[model samples]
Target chain A: MARVVVDVMLKPEILDPQGQAVANALPRLGVTDVSSVRIGRRIEIDFTGEADLDRAREIADKLLANPVIEDYEVRLVEGAEVA
Target chain B: MARVVVDVMLKPEILDPQGQAVANALPRLGVTDVSSVRIGRRIEIDFTGEADLDRAREIADKLLANPVIEDYEVRLVEGAEVA
Candidate 1:
């Protein structure tokens, strides 16, 4: 089995309200000194056999991520460990 | 500056409808992937001056992640990269 990890985040130019919400909430929780926060997505795909990284990248670039506003990176997680 | 990365995912036993939705959408996108998909969150925190990892972990455990139904891991990103 192959485990592919895709990390997707909004572009720097875009405003992330979700991240802003988290950042605003931090100080209320007595967690200070944080300058900023950005929230993104981590997608894990488990392939039964012959985990193909290229196909995973295709999937990420095409359907998994919005290339216009977001950026994504695809990589193989060691040991193909998925629960 | 310290860049902290927090990866949070639903527990294995918990149902992930979002991930299922993504998996179900893949075939329609002409992307055939064998097996399952799990979607999680990646939170990046950028701290100004003297990045402290333990404090970041504390914040993650307390405010960033729900330990009851979700599992989270915290690590320091090479550089404080948060947009």
Candidate 2:
């Protein structure tokens, strides 16, 4: 089996209130030296056949992410040897 | 500024309904080759002084993630010159 990871994040132009909230919460919890925060989603897809990165990217771009507001990248998980 | 990333995932024992929902939605979107799906969080923190990985881990454990049900790993973002 192979695992493909898709990292999705809001575009730089998009507003991320949740990330701002996290940055705001840091100091309240005494995690002061911290400056800013941005939050995103990680989606892991398991494939039973070949480790086809292109298919994963297609899945990410078409179904898993919103291209209008979020950016997504698909990559194979390390150490999934395919022979 | 330096950016640190904290990747958080639900424990294997924890139920991930959101992930399952995504998996279920895939077939409808014609992404049929996929076998399984797992969803998680990726948090990016921008620090001003130094890229303190330990501090980022602490923030993830105490403030950013729920240690009881989720596991998190901290790492420095690639290519944030720290000199």
Candidate 3:
């Protein structure tokens, strides 16, 4: 089996209200001295067997994330070698 | 300025409904052949001048992520070295 990792982040030019909200909530949660915060998304998927990495990237671009509003990267997780 | 990148993911023991929802939504959006999806959170913070990386990790542990329900990793962005 193989594990795929996906990281999704908002476009720098796009305003991130959710990120701002998390930043605002930080201090209240006893985490002081923080300057700023920007929140995004992370996803992991497990494949039953060897799969095409290129196809995974295609899925990421077409449906997993919004290319115009978000940026993403996909990689194979280490240490999942099959017997 | 220094940019701190934070990645947060659910504990292996916890069930990720949001991730499952995203996974289910994929095929509808024309992304087929996908098996699973697990979603988490990512955060980035900018620190003015040289700041303590240790303190940033502390904030990440205490506020940016829930230690009990989530795991996180923080790193400085590359190519931001000041002259």
Candidate 4:
């Protein structure tokens, strides 16, 4: 089986309150060096045949990510251990 | 600034309904070679000083991932383009 990984992140201009909440709580953890935090999605698509970048990209564009608020990157992962 | 990436994924045995929903819709997109789809979270933490893998891992373990259902990997990212 071939695997394609898609990383979907919020647009730079978008506000990520979830990440901000994590950042805010860090001070209590005594972690003072962290400046920012951004949270997003990672999707793994396994193909029964060969890894198809085009198909994965289409899936990412159409189903996985919101183009208006998110940006996604698609790439093939060789020997990925994740199930 | 240094960046750390934490990828949080559901344990292989866990049921991923969200991923299944996407996989079910792929046939309508004219894609049928896919075997499986898994979805998870990707978090980016920026450090004002040097990259701290240990601190990032601690943050991921304590705040980011629920140890019961999720597995998280933390690593330093050099020259990453994502915001």
Which prediction has the highest TM-score against the true structure? 4
Where does model 4 exceed 4 Å of error?
B81-83
lDDT of 1 by residue, B12-47 (tens): 988999999878887886767558899999988888
Per-candidate DockQ vs. reference: 0.74, 0.76, 0.52, 0.94
Write one digit per residue (lDDT tens) for candidate 2, span B1-83. 78898999898789899889888887777767777788999888888877889888888887778989998889888886433
**Residue A69 CA displacement from its true place in model 4, Å:** 0.7
Residues A1-83 of candidate 2 have per-residue lDDT tens digits of 88899999898788899989878888777777777787899888888776679878877887779999999988888875432
True contacts kept of each: 0.82, 0.85, 0.71, 0.93
Candidate 2 residue spans exceeding 4 A from truth = A80-83, B80-83
Whole-model Cα lDDT of every candidate shown, in order: 0.85, 0.83, 0.76, 0.94
The interface RMSD values of the models, given in order, are 1.4, 1.3, 2.7, 0.4
Residue B29 Cα positional deviation in candidate 4, in Å, after optimal superposition? 0.5
Q: Can you write out model 4's per-residue Cα lDDT over B3-78, one digit (the tens) per residue?
A: 9999999999999999999999999999999999999999999999888999999999889999999999998888
User: Which docking band does candidate 3 fall into?
Assistant: medium
Q: Residue A64's C-alpha lDDT in candidate 1?
A: 78
Arrange candidates, best DockQ first: 4, 2, 1, 3
TM-score of chain B of 1: 0.86
TM-score of each: 0.89, 0.88, 0.75, 0.96
Docking class of 1: medium
